[model samples]
Target chain A: MEKKIYKPTDIDIERLSALARISLSDTEKESFSCDIATMATYVSSLLSDVSAEHEREARSLDELREDTPVECDCARDILALSPSLKEDHVAVPLVVGKDKEGDA
Target chain B: MNELIFRSLDEHKRALTAREYSSEELTRAYLERIEEKEPSINSFVSLCQDRAIDAAKESDERRRNGAPLSALDGIPYAAKDNIAVAGLPLRCGSRILEGYISPFDATVISRLKSSGCVLLGKTNLDEFAMGTDTETSANGRTKNPLDENRVTGGSSGGSAAAVAAYEAPFTLGSDTGGSVRQPAAFCGIVGLRPTYSALSRYGLVGFSPSLDTIGILSRSASECADIMNATVGADSRDATSRPFPASDLRALIGKDVRGMRIGVVREAIGEGLSEEVLEAMQVATDTLRSLGAKMTEISLPHLHAAYAVYYAFSSAEAASNLSRFDGVRYGYRAESCGSIEELYERSRAEGFGDEVKRRVLFGNFALSGENREKIYGRAVAMRKQIIAELSSVLSRCDLLLLPTASTHAYRAGVKKSALYCKDDLLCTLAALAGLPALSLPYHRDGKLPVGIQLMGPAFSEDRLFSVAHLLESALDRRESAK
Candidate 1:
């Protein structure tokens, strides 16, 4: 298989920054140039072998599970683990910005 | 007889079912032994007295009522601390999770409990399951039970040590590369890493989601097989959990391997293999040949790149899996952090051990935005090639037999040459291939034990176990005569 060449444009950096969940300074970005491009090239290779031809559309991660009975005990555990649970619902701080897509 | 502790797990189960021993009596004896021998070995991070006694009482009650859960219902088992057991501290041998408790039991633990197995407690492991030696554990290094100055092979060192110390009959461990089998070999026990996806990964604190599998350590291959049979199946909660057709497999002991082809991977048996280890492999094959198994040599071209591939993928997975430890919701968050960032860095920096931080840094470097392709990406591709090469070779062979690890257990923190230091990777090919592999105790060179690794096609665990059982019997007979 011929390798794909990738250039890390500003948008690619933005995506990677979100993926890594670490803020990058300008010098950090400059240092990361070759690495970002390299990783993108590799990801594209794995994507090539995925054979998306079998599926008409890719479903979201949460939608991947089949319709099945949800165990009450499991749900209880989730609620018990949540820090800000109020009447069986988890409370979370309002986000400063929306999350990047396709991160999962 | 303490001989029961050394017997095959299957035999003990059968004997227990035949009214030979009550579950209560067995649990009591093991508990007493753990109390006596566990201090020096440091095999367990936590001991589940209440849970074990409760289960034992219930088991005795069931027996008195003329009903039994299963032959293994009352069997006591230990779990590596990396695996979660509800209400028990799931400390991954790191200070970060020192006081952390799991909200739910790991799938394997839950399955064993459902089958009436008693939870002995959580065994020790390397911190966050990062190091090859268990010495990096925050809870102190687990000393080899056989030779205290020598180390128990790790990061599943405690799981192996527990079985060796007879603190528990069997234990569950995770095998990413050779964590389970390497330690088992050192501890002179049987460790089975079932084919990838055989058991669910849910509730396991140890990361490396793609490569990690729940493995079993037992005194005998049949005992390992029994646990595998109970734990291997599909779980809707686990996205990668695959079904293993276990019911149809016969537990063949001393079965003939007439016309069966066995390949010894040249890459797996390389330079620096100890004289004892090399001799053990030769003797094992000679015995297998006498049992009618044909042997040949096979080469995996990508085997040289297999370790690199494993580190890349395993670390990348590690980087992602460990991101949850920000001290936000639970676990050991920083106590005196001035701010959120301080809390995050200090909690991790202070809580994690030196080896863990080093690997995480390395993993972060590989998985970082700039270098992901050169390291993690190349490694993934290499992983595929290794698996493909392994698959193609398996079409011509019924099994592959080789050394489990290049050499026997080393003394604590004794570093070998660069080539020899990393020789553990030689035996991890079957792990990377996602094939079912068995490490059976073959011989002990008076320093520590060496294991004979038997690898078979993916999902061919029963057949692999059958061969291992035969070999184990032959070795055991020889040992007894000696």
Candidate 2:
């Protein structure tokens, strides 16, 4: 299989930051694009060189705790830590366009 | 009694018990040292002076009533900012979480508290514990106690420097990929990354869940063992934590290593290792050999791929973990945003440092498209191979010996590059395999100390500490003779 070469551009970084939900300044986009491109090339080389025969198994869930309900008083404390709280719940800026004032 | 700040945890405990010095006095001395050294070393992010003094007073009262909490009663220690301490700001060395106070104590902190260990404060780390040097911390870079110009290896640099500067007798640091051990090595102290799951990760801010471990840094291996003895146990809150049986780690310190076999990773000492560090490893191996331990060169062929594997796995996990820092619930929020997306984008953009942003972007890129299978999948496969190879090599010997880092701590503001990855390469092998590893300061190249790393099979901290204690004693004797 032919490997796809990675050459990150400012557009790619912009899209990636969007996907990551992180806004990048114009200066940051230029520099991060280069750094990501360099890292991508390095990772590509490393991936292409290594054999892919061995697959490591993740930890088994057999030892996981039983789903027993337990009361915790941490909710009040967690709400207190919120940047913006409406009553007992965390509040955030309107997500749906319909909820915005400018939207009809 | 001011010198009590430099004494071992055991010595401090004895002094407290013998009434030679009050816990209040001991805590005061450490607090004073922190005040004096903090400007030069830049270790602590928040100093819990009032709380520590109150705790010290409580400890004094307990001892006076003949009801001391534990062997570590009244001993002052610091925790890396990532570890949650109730009422203490858990900034995690990042602007993103600045002023975020923890509502609950981490399992390790609670355990330490139950034992009456006085918490001096929280130490700085790489922002979100992502970088090798503490320079990435938004709080400011932590300098090496020995040389202010040099970096304290990070992201546990502050914890290491705090101990090295005698600001605290011991401090807790978390290691994902050599964070604890590397900084410990750089600062010339004992740092142990216990077997994964040996210590609870419930309260440590996640970096790479599978690889993150709460570790201890102290002036002596025995103190690390003491802290380990008190802290290592299962927590139902953390599914990854196992039921680790309590062992008298201190009792194992002076045990004989007459027939113990140590494997020296041939790959570790190659190419990137500095001459001074390599020379230190040679002397350390020789010292261990003279102490009746046998040494053999062993190969873990997949070892060289550790940095790539670690980056692929850790970055992916870090991206996921850091995703929680949206503007809504907690932490730094962007001042003004019309939409949720902008809120998240602007908050993260403004809050996260450059290195963190780069990694998160890299993670997104790697996880998208065919790159996921080509990079992430192959990395997963290589991780298994690395683990298998290390297991096989470890089966032949009691422990693996290597350099904690490729070189001594670099100058502050050294650019992050591929070359810097070499610092984490040696330590990543043990981390990847979920085995216990320790960095013990063995030699000094000028003012900087070189650390020799010892890694052992899973849950083999007892034997690892035994070998390290012996090596530490021999090195001390040699230094005293000189």
Candidate 3:
């Protein structure tokens, strides 16, 4: 099997930051890009031609707990901790709609 | 009253039982000492004054009725902010978790509370337990109690500092890689990172789930054993947790190390080790030899690759674990956002610190579809090899001894990013293998203390404590004889 070489660049870092849902400043991106490039060289050498085996078998189903629900009094406390809240649910910015100006 | 703050758990119990002072009085002394020393140490992120007092009073009452919970009934300790304590702010030393309060206690907290241990407050840490130095904490960096100009090595720095400063007798910290051991070494105290799954992790804010383990920082190895005895047990909430087979975790204390096989990791001794640390290691080895323990030199060929492998795997895990911190729920929210995606981006970008962003970006890069097979997959393979090598070595020897960090605590505000990566190599072997490791401080005259580490095979925490206690006592005698 041929192993593909991976070297992280500025574009790669930008793509990663976006994928990670984090907006980074240009300077920050540049700094991280440099660090990642350094790390890339180190990682490539250490991991070259290595292949991973499947992880050890997980606990069997019989060992797992029954998927059941029980009542508790934590809801009120949990709700109180939310940053923005409605009557019974956490509030967030619009998920599907466009701007207030209706540009979309 | 002030002296009570430094007393061991057993001594405190005897004092309380004999009515030298009430638990409330002892609690008050600690609180006052915290107030006095906090300016210099900056160890605590918050103070649970009211809660501690109430719990201390309750403990006093329990003792008055001759129904004290246990030996730890009146002891006060702090938890790293990353661990949940119901109704207390769980910022995790990051702005992202700012204003967030945990609704329920973590399993360890629950266990400690049940044992009648009073929670002094939450201590500081590197944001989300990412950095080796506590400098990255949003709360403020924790200074080494031994040297004001130096850092208490972190992400467990505050916990170690609190104990070292005598603001609290002991504190809880979490280890992933070397967070617990490094800080304990830096603060001149004992730190224990038990075998993974020996303690529950239900409420610990996960940085790297596979590597993360809640650890103890205290003045003595026996105290660590006491804390472990109280906290070690299986919990349904944490599936990984298992019942420790040993009934008495401290049963090995005071036992001689004669004929015990100690493997000295050869790679850890040369090149990068500071002169003082090398001398300390010599003293430790000489002490063990004098005590009749058999010391042999051993090497881990993969030791050089550990730093890169640890970062790759831990970063991948961190990326996944930290993905839950969007603005919708309990943490900080951006002022304005046109869409949910924007909210997440802005909230995270603003909320996270530089090191976090660096790791997240790198993690995502490594785990990306094209690179995942090359980086993360290979890291997985490398981890297995490391673990196998450690297991093989442990089979040959009862324990592995090495310096906990390459040097004593470095002065605060040094360029930490590169320096920390190198310093942490000594600590990752135990974390990678899920083995029990303990760090015992070796003091030097007019210089910061050096940490000598002992690692044993999985589930060997009891033996590790015994050996550490014997070594600690021997070191103490040597110091006094000087």
Give the number of the best model, judged by lDDT.
3
Where in model 3 is the C-alpha error above 4 Å?
Answer: A1-11, A49-104, B418-420, B477-482
* Model 1 spans with C-alpha error above 4 angstroms: A1-104, B1-8, B248-255, B415-421, B444-447, B477-482
Q: Taking candidate 2, what TM-score does its chain B reach relative to the real chain B? A: 0.97
Clashes of each: 4, 0, 0
Candidates, ranked, TM-score: 2, 3, 1
Candidate 2 lDDT over B1-482, as tens digits, reads 37777677778878888989999999999998988888878999999899999999999999999999988899999999999988889998888897688877999999999999999999999998888889889999999988899989888999999999999999999999999999998888999999999999988997789889999999888889999988998999899999775467777777788888999989888688888788778887898888888989999786777887888888888788889998766689998699878899899988998888888888887788766677777777778778878878877999989999988888888846433464478888888889999999865434477788989988888888888887886544345336
The residue-level lDDT of candidate 1 at B209 comes to 74
Order the numbered candidates by lDDT, best leading.
Answer: 3, 2, 1
lDDT (Cα, tens digit) per residue for candidate 3, span B333-451: 88779998999999999999988887887788788876676677677777777787788898999999999998889889994673247557789989888999999998765778879
Ranking by DockQ: 2, 3, 1
Per-prediction TM-score to the true structure, in the order listed: 0.82, 0.90, 0.90
Interface RMSD of each: 9.9, 6.2, 6.7
> Candidate 1 versus the native: TM-score?
0.82
Q: Which candidate gets the maximum DockQ versus the true structure?
A: 2
Compared with the true structure, what per-residue lDDT tens digits does model 3 show for residues A1-104?
Answer: 34344344533766888888999888887878878777766675766634334222111211567689878789886754455866997554432233443321
Which ten contiguous residues of candidate 1 chain B have the minimum total lDDT?
A: B415-424
Model 3: DockQ vs. true structure: 0.27
- Runs in model 2 deviating more than 4 A are A1-5, A55-104, B417-419, B476-482
Global lDDT of each candidate: 0.74, 0.84, 0.85
Query: What DockQ values do the models have?
Result: 0.06, 0.30, 0.27
